[model samples]
Target: MQLKQELIQQIQSIIATAKERAIRSVDTERVLMYWQIGQVIQEEEQQGKERAGYGEFLIKSLSETLQPQFGSGFSVRQLEMCRQFYRTFPNTNALRSQFSWTHYRTLIRIENQDKREFYIAEAAKNNWTARQLERQVNSQLFERLLLSNDVKEVLAVARDEKQPSDAKEIIKDPMVLEFLGLKREAAYYEKDLEAAIITHLQEFLLEIGNGFSFVARQKRIHIEGDEFSIDLVFYNRLLQCFVLFEIKTTKLTHQDIGQLQMYVNYYDRFEKQEFENPTIGILLCADKNDAVVKITLPENNKTIIASKYQLYLPTEQQLIDEVKKEIEKLDHDKMNE
Candidate 1:
């Protein structure tokens, strides 16, 4: 019976693997097909430059001919998308095979070259599904990262041109937790939020940034007959450090920062391996004032951060305003320095 069970398991594994490969193969071929079609359309349009509306006319005519034969995949909108995809990613060598047509579909819509490139590198590195990539794009992940880091550093980290030495390089402030299915108006306890995080750990990890793995919940520590329980703990392989979280369901105060800092100090002093990077602390708060946090932490502080958690995803206008505010703050900090 045991031998038969093992054989069944091995066969199941082989079937699943084969199915996955087959899907990948089909997706890759479809992407190549679309790219080639787009290339032909672009070349033909250029060849008929004598006509003013030739490009638009050409796409419509091609779609009319192909859609009836090939189904809606060759419809006017899809064909236009194909042309745009080819235009956005001109180099055939640059197309990543892991991406599906959906991934390229979302990517081609992005107008900014840097933002598009950043998402491309990050999506490829992280193996984000089309939905995951779309969520990050909608959440304004790139713009949020720019709140603390400059454009050059952000791009470099995304490209893996430089390792992330700072937590801010990857962590986003005002993290979107709409995935938790929590209501915005309702009051939530620290435990409630903590439970939600654990329940949706995968999405939480994606929102938090790269290279994080769950470690412990209500992580307890002892010091000279005293006891304390940290809210959550995570290990970041990229940063080579333990990240401790202290949840606050209200506006942040200095005490919150102090408490998180203590946990960070405890981790660094007692839990951290000698070769590992310093343990970092994050105060996940309902709200935060930037000035208060700056005054609470030491000038040279790198380990402690105060990040606001939003129950709902912000509108595009809200994200834009947030970015503008942070840029102004950066300018203010520079002048004070």
Candidate 2:
């Protein structure tokens, strides 16, 4: 019986290893093929004999021939992608083996080279699947990073050589909770939003960005013979600190900030290990008064953060405008300094 169990376990391990290798081999081959296709397209374009229309004609002809012998992978659109795949990544040696064709297809859509490179490096380092990569790109991760950090820091982190060391680097403002399916106009309580977050914890964490891991929901803390229940608690591996979150369905007020500060103090005093950094608190509210938040928290405060939350995704124009406004504000502040 023991011998049979050992044999079965060995067979399973071998099969798993074989499957992993097969997938990697196929991915590498596909990437190389795209690189070669791109090289051919570039060479053809450089040849003055082909002219503009000739290149299109050549691709169409190639697709027509290959589609019959090959499979749907040889469709005209996919062939064009192969050409672009090469054009976008001119250096064949620079092509990362960590990414697949789908990853490249999503990346090529990004017009900004710097932004594209950032996404590529991040996706590779995080081992993001194609769908996750698409989400990050669509969510304007690069723009958000630019808003939160200096240009050099953003570039360094995006390139995966270094990570942001401050709380500001990982914290996002007006977190998009579209997955919650809550209507913007609907009147909801704080508990309602907390319930939705708990129900869709995995999706919420992904939308919350990197380094966050679920710790507890409705985490109970006792202080001075009184008990307090925090809405959600998380520990950021990157920051090496405990994160306490308080949910508010209405606009954040001084009371909201005060309550969260108390929570942060409690965690810092009682729960956090001496080796860990001070506990951080986040007030996830539906709305906020910027002036009030600024006055309520101390200047250069790092322990507590108050950010707005949106039940739905904002329009692309809105995101662009917001980023532009933030950049303008930074410029104004820098000029004053």
Candidate 3:
């Protein structure tokens, strides 16, 4: 009976693998066809000496002819999209087979060449589905990372040109938790938030960035006669260290940093192995003051980080405000120096 069950499972796995490969093959062919269409349209459009009007007429006429026989996939908008796709990724040889037509459409809409390239490398490296790619774009993941690091470092890390040396490289600040279904207006305790995170662990892990895996929550430890609980703990494969998180429902204070520092110290002294890197401490607070954090931690501190959390994704104005704050902080630091 056991042997029969094992044989059935093996057959099921083989069938599933074949089905997935077949889907990927079809998607690859469709992507290639669109790129070819785009190439032809682009060549013909360039041949017309006329400006804007000629390109529009050509695309519209082609769409009308193709839609009748080939269906709505050849609509004017789609043709325009294909044209843009080819223009964005001019080299046919450079087009990634892993990306579907939807992925190409999303990438084509991004006007910035460098940003597009970063997303392309990251999407390919991470094997992000079309919807996952779209969510990251919509959530402004790239811009959020840029809030602390510069474009050069961001792109280099994504392209594997440089390995991440700091937690800030991989962990995003002001993490958006709109996926938790927690209402922005509603107040949540640290425990409630922790429960929500446990429920939506997958999305939380995705938003937290790469190379992280969950370890424990409310991890209790006793030091001599005293007892303490750590909110959350994770292991980062890339950094090769244990990440300790302490959640705060209100604004971060010096005490919060000190407590988290204690947790980090405990892990480093007792939990960490000699082969592993130092444990990293992170405070997921509703709000945090940069000045307070800077004052609390030593200038050479690398293991401690305080990140703000938001229930909802920020609006355009909110991002602008955050950028302004970053600039002001830089100016303030320079002046203090």
Worst 10 residues of 2 by lDDT: 41-50
Candidate 3 on 26-113: residue-level lDDT in tens? 9999998988899999999999947768999999999889999999999999999888888888888998989998898888888987
Better of 1 and 2 by TM-score: 1
Q: Give per-residue CA lDDT, model 2, range 170-238, as digits (tens).
A: 677768887788998999988888888889998787777678899998999888899989999999987
Residue-pair clashes per candidate, as listed? 0, 0, 0
TM-score comparison, 1 vs 3, better candidate:
1
The residue-by-residue lDDT of candidate 1 on 1-337, one tens digit each, is 2568888999999999999999999999999999988888888988998999999999999889988888988988998888888898888999999999999998999999999999999999999999999999988899889878888999999889999999999999888899999999999999999999999999999999999999999989998999999999999999999999999999999988988888888888999999999999999999989999999899999999899999887898998898889878888989988
Best by lDDT: 1
- TM per model? 0.96, 0.90, 0.95
lDDT of 1: 0.92
Report lDDT per candidate: 0.92, 0.83, 0.90
Candidate order by lDDT, decreasing, is 1, 3, 2
Is candidate 1 or 2 superior in lDDT? Answer: 1
